[model samples]
Target: MAGLEVPTWDPQTAMLIGAILFEAIILYVGYGGLEKLVGPRLMELLVGGESGVSQ
Candidate 1:
């Protein structure tokens, strides 16, 4: 019976990992921008207008 051998480094695997990482970064930035654009409006709608404390 043959034992399992360790896999060699492969460029294709590296590229796949890099693609996933790149996509994750893009999604993070997109969501951050969307949050910045809509977050205050959404908070005001939920809380029924601004707080009494001055900014």
Candidate 2:
């Protein structure tokens, strides 16, 4: 075994952050797509039949 050392800042850090950011973006896009695909159906199921405000 050997002594461990703290990591210093470098291009790898940027790449790691970028990868995480990209993953987050992909997840956001995927969820957004799914929402668009199913959001109406969900809304209809949850609140479509009811009027939110009475005139």
Q: Give candidate 1's error at residue 16 in angstroms.
A: 0.7
lDDT of 2: 0.84
Query: lDDT for model 1, on a 0 to 1 scale?
Result: 0.86
TM-score of 2: 0.64
Tens-digit per-residue lDDT, 1-55, candidate 2 = 3568776779989899999999999999999999999887787787764443335
Off-target runs (Cα >4 Å) in candidate 2 are 1-9, 49-55
Query: Which lDDT tens digits does candidate 1 get at residues 1-55?
Result: 3668776879999899999999999999999999999988887887756653445
For model 2, give the 10-residue run with minimal summed lDDT: 46-55
Q: What is the C-alpha lDDT of each candidate?
A: 0.86, 0.84
Query: In candidate 2, residue 35 scores what lDDT?
Result: 100
User: What are the per-model C-alpha RMSD values against the true structure?
Assistant: 4.9, 6.0
Best by lDDT: 1
Best by TM-score: 1
